[model samples]
Target chain A: MAIINYANKEVQFKIVFYGPALCGKTTNLAYIHSQITETNKGELVSLATAADRTLFFDFLPLNAIVIRNFKTKFQLYTVPGQVIYNATRQLVLRSVDAVVFVADSQWDKMEENIESFRNLDENLARQGLSLDTIPYVIQLNKRDMPNVAPIHYLDFILNDRAVCVPSFEASATTGQGVFDTLNTVSRMLLVKFARDAEAAAYVKSQPTPAASPMDGVAAGLRQPQAAR
Target chain B: MQSTPIVTIAAAEKFLKTLEEFLNHSEAFFALIIDRGGTILSQSGRPPDGTDITILAALAAGSFAATRELATRVGESEFNALYQQGSHFHILMNAVDDDTMLVTIFSTQTTVGLVRFYSARTSEQIAIQMQELRADCVDAPLVFTEADLNTASQIFRDTTDKAV
Candidate 1:
């Protein structure tokens, strides 16, 4: 869920980039941080081990594209993708509004991709959410590699959901398909948010039905009657 | 799904005032109230030049979450506060509620004892305000039309069209 602060006229969304080890989740963020205008971005913060593997997560804050007089800010995060870091991954998923699943495209990494995807599902389930309920996009990354699997195979394995989500083929190192993945996910999130808000507003606008005598009697029976 | 939290202007003003008072009492260089998810809700006092408050809030929340996990591994439910001592600057983060935290950054000018004392008091006050804010929060619907969505999409495309 987004945090909307009327005081600052700011609406913020948390987007997490999740994938298996060395799948270029941080590479995607680093490229975005370098390309975006300085005024529109904050410092790129990475908590990594001495060997440069992500120890905790990578965070980047971006302010872009105001809508309806409110500045839209995005707090982008990338979780440590190693299997042992599942705990940290779950923590990073907290309060995330959208996700970009960076799937490694190399044929040899298919099993790790599947495992990470299942881990993502389990973590989201712990928060009472699922891919069907949340807006997410799949990025078939490392497409520039020679041993990459075909797009159709990756889609059949990962995007075989109730509804096929937008997936992009990318080489994050070269910035290919990075922005496309981000832009598509962001647009989907905004549209879904708008639709949900509209539905909630409609429900709120409906008049409540008056309780009949039997309903009142049942309510009275459920709770002790107040003294007259 | 948990309801999205909204901080109204009045509520923000109240929180800022509380944070300002905490800064004054503790003589901290900076103070902030960040949600557990790492979004900064309110802040007070001036940060050093070249400091990015947004990153500060995000890192603080991350540090706090990691510490809480450590606490759980040690058989404790959670740690109430975290203190980091640097040679020049120090930070004290206190849990305001399950969903929010109070972070104070100070220098050698103030003692840790004083900052901790004031942070505890301020956390209670902010927690009360948070309770009230949550109770009064109405799911303010975003009245976005299809045109609005199209305009937003166009803006994003324009911004990213030429990658620097």
Candidate 2:
């Protein structure tokens, strides 16, 4: 519910990073903030420290080119990676417009990564939103590590759960593929924004107001119907 | 809710000229800038009327006030944005720079394709003006006083209480 006004116009969108501990979620943001011109990004503020980790969240405001005179912006955040931070992660997922799950591509952390992914599904389900309903992407980081779990195995688990989503591979330490990953997911999210606007218009053009927020805003865009 | 009362004559003339130019360039059907209390500072659009805004603002203010209390109780130092959508309208509020609110009513003609782009510019512009207005408001601002409340209550009693 944060209202952002820029250029006398306002555009609001949110992106959340989800993944296991040390999966390079923060690193991706550090790289993006560094790579882009500072003018395009505001101060990267991290909230209080909880035992030396992100206590609440990290917020970075990034501006996109204006369309039709309305400005577009994204608030990027990363959930604390420790398993103990489950409640905080769920809070971050609330009202998220897009998600980028950073996976640790090493053999040792395979189980941790898989469990984190499952946690994401459960959390989203509780909110009545699914990964499928919102724009979601995955990044398999630490590819340079030796004996990393095979991408195929990772794919099998994800696809097997019908959790298929846009994904990439990279070594976050080396800053590879991170920006490209964010850019793609952001573009997809914008497209979803367009779709939502259309749904809003159609809903209003109706002869009468819909019975509920669920009926009006759901738009059948994110909710997977049985047909699929 | 009735459309916002034509702002004070001085405020109305000034806002109308500037906002007309703004609307022409941006092409948003209707826009409003209100204080946190939901008082209409200045507006440009086919807002219903003053009487409507009186009730609408009360409802919106009640919602904001309740949410503020909710946030405080939960130890949330700050309140986030607020929005209410109906069949023909989308009501959006963002706390810009901790003062004034940027509220807009969008019709079907406004597109997501175009809204973000225009809204950002408008937000920034409104933010600056609102800061100044908030300052002036502190000095000698309009307030919905207890007397106004008593008057309203008596009128309601006269209208509904009489009927009852």
Candidate 3:
């Protein structure tokens, strides 16, 4: 979660762009980087290794002003594709405030979509979090393909108690529903954050304790010059 | 279910602001909360920046369970605290009332007194927050994903080695 401080107010949230590999996850980000007004997004840092693979991750920061009083900020990220990157994928699912599960929607990719969706559920369980509890969305990418699955079919598969995660169909390559999907997720994020605010307010009036982190944890955050 | 105690935004802000201040003065990484069962509630610090905390929380839970097993072998029910001092810094986890944990990251640059001073205060603050959450937890059942941790230890170890 990226924390933002504005006029003495702060909001911290996380946005995850989850999808099957090469469903234009990176392309969606590239488009956002090029189109957004500078004040919105942060530096798109991609930590790649010698072979040019996403060794660590890529980060995109964006802000929203929905409530008249509170300002919200989101840290958007894409888990490295490829099944072998499972460890990295697990790590990216932490403290996610909201999720956009982008699906590869060409007709032949049905199995991949289902697998990716299942993988998302699996990872959430590891963190003791579930789609049923957290706010999430579904995005159908590569929608322009000739053999893309019907929207109804894809929707039926994803529907659940946490069912029917809000979804959008877009050709991320052509900059279709990308922004609209983002906007939908961002709005949902604000709604959830507001709930937290309400809970926080109620807790404070009672002189209650807060869940705290270990000492030296935050204070000791450094870039670590290559981990000597 | 009724909620735990409430954790107001004002309270969290004050606590986090203090936390940010502490982070500004120190160079620690990876401090988070662990349950009696080792589930993580929240985390602060810089190490898991790119990595996901949800995943780390589960791993920490696993590590905590491992710690309990190790403690039991020595005739103890649980391990109150655990620390691993790498070449450059410290990874510390302190047990609080069996129901919660206070994990911290430290460096030799700061004196032990400073670490103690901050932790004692922060622990109380976190304890308060936990109580609030407990009062109103919406207790949702979660399914664990075995595949995510499927990396044969060597693969994970290799990645850390490569990163370091």
Stretches off by above 4 angstroms in model 1 are A218-228, B1-4, B139-147, B153-164
- On lDDT, the leading prediction is 1
TM-score of each: 0.93, 0.53, 0.55
Residues B1-164, candidate 3: write the lDDT tens digits. 12222234444455466456555554455466554332334455676435545444444544555676678889999876676667666666666554566767777766545665666666777766666555533331111122322321211011112111
For all candidates, state DockQ relative to the true structure.
Answer: 0.52, 0.02, 0.02
Q: In candidate 2, what are the lDDT values of residues A1-228, reduced to their tens digit?
A: 222232245455668888888888887777666666655676665654655476545666676655555555666878788898776676666556788989998888888988998998898887677877878888888888888888887766554545577778877667677766777677677666566545645565678645886765677877677874
- Which parts of model 2 have CA positions greater than 4 angstroms off? A1-7, A48-52, A159-163, A206-228, B1-164
lDDT tens readout by residue for model 1, B84-134 = 999989999999988899999899999999999999999999989988888
C-alpha displacement of A204 in model 1, angstroms? 2.0
Give the worst 10-residue stretch by lDDT in candidate 3 chain B: B155-164
Pitting candidate 2 against candidate 3, the one with the higher TM-score is 3
Q: B160, model 2: CA deviation in Å?
A: 70
For model 2 chain B, the run of ten residues with the poorest summed lDDT: B154-163
User: In candidate 1, which residue pairs clash?
Assistant: none
What is the fraction of true interface contacts found in candidate 3? Answer: 0.00
Q: Model 2: per-residue lDDT, tens digit, B94-137?
A: 45445345555565666543544555666666666544443432
